[model samples]
Target: MRAEEQVEAVVVDDIAERLRDGSREALEEAYARWASLVHTLAVRSLGNHHDAEDVTQQVFVSAWNSRHTLRPDKGTVPGWLVGITRHKVADVHAKRARLARDAQAVAENTLPDESAPPPDDLLATRLVLHDELERLGEPRGTIVRMAFLEDRTHDEIAERLAMPLGTVKSHVRRGLLHLRTRLEEVDRDPS
Candidate 1:
């Protein structure tokens, strides 16, 4: 074997021996020796250093916690750590996939259908209509808002405003024409 690999194998063998004898320092030495390899594997699989760090921590915690269950006769320390790292990496991938699916579901639920007018266009139209109504002012604006927006009838408007029925009808017709003209002008010259 190469120099570093031979040294690593020796270190792994030593750590395994310490662990089997219930040495308290074995776990720390195990983490020091293998943490980079575990973290590197996690980062490659997860594509993010933050997630890789979390997985690396989880792998060591799981290894330390389950140290008593390990069979040193059946496996080396590095082999056991590699298994733990695999499981941690899988868990991270599952979490990332779940988060991605949840975000997609939320977007689908909140967004309008593709066929509908875009939100910005709808908002701009409402604002422009409101501005034009304000510019109309006085009886025409008030009458139009009541008749269309409030769903009021001509008789209701005339009696509410204390005016002649013919005057309310005239205002409704002229206001509609004026709004149509204003809207058409805006549509033609959007700038």
Candidate 2:
């Protein structure tokens, strides 16, 4: 290796060691050295500047959070950051795909008519609500789905799920409340 390369490697190793030992400045140094590389990778993969920026931030935060998992003997700091960037990019892609799927689902669920189409905001709102409902999970998601989406009565859901009518009612009530809270949060999130 060239003399300058050797010196740079020594400096990089020092920073990685300090980072693994919990030095915040070392983390900053690492970010300064590689943030652009990370951001470029994200932009190349995601094709959106805002998503790229978000992914870059996510990668650094994840790297700091997972610093102890870094093994300098196994790889350079840039290599580790690249790995994290790949994962973050993949996460953004997966999230996009999931949203697309949710949108398609909403479209499919809507009444089909040549005369009228659902408004964009209505579709977006349904997508958000569907996502929130998924986050609810388990018996609550099932109960709410039956009660609202499938247009089944509480007694019918209780009989179908083999749960007490009161329990079914409770799940639907709480699930709807949680969905409402999540909707409000989405309304407030700006991004």
The most accurate candidate by TM-score is 2
Off by over 4 Å in 1: 1-11, 20-22, 114-191
For every candidate, C-alpha RMSD to the true structure in Å: 21.6, 11.1
Q: Give the per-residue lDDT of model 1 (tens digit) for 38-120.
A: 99998998899988998899988888778776776788887888899999888767655654554355335434456876677
Whole-model lDDT per candidate: 0.77, 0.84
Hey, what RMSD does candidate 2 come out at? 11.1
Task: Name the TM-score of candidate 1.
Answer: 0.54
Backbone N/Cα/C clashes per model: 0, 0
Q: Candidate 2 residues 18-122, lDDT tens each?
A: 999999999999999999999999999999998899899989999999999989999999999999999988877776675455445544564344477568666
After the best TM-score superposition of candidate 1, give how far the Cα of residue 110 lies from its true spot, in angstroms. 0.4
TM-score of each: 0.54, 0.62
Candidate with best lDDT: 2
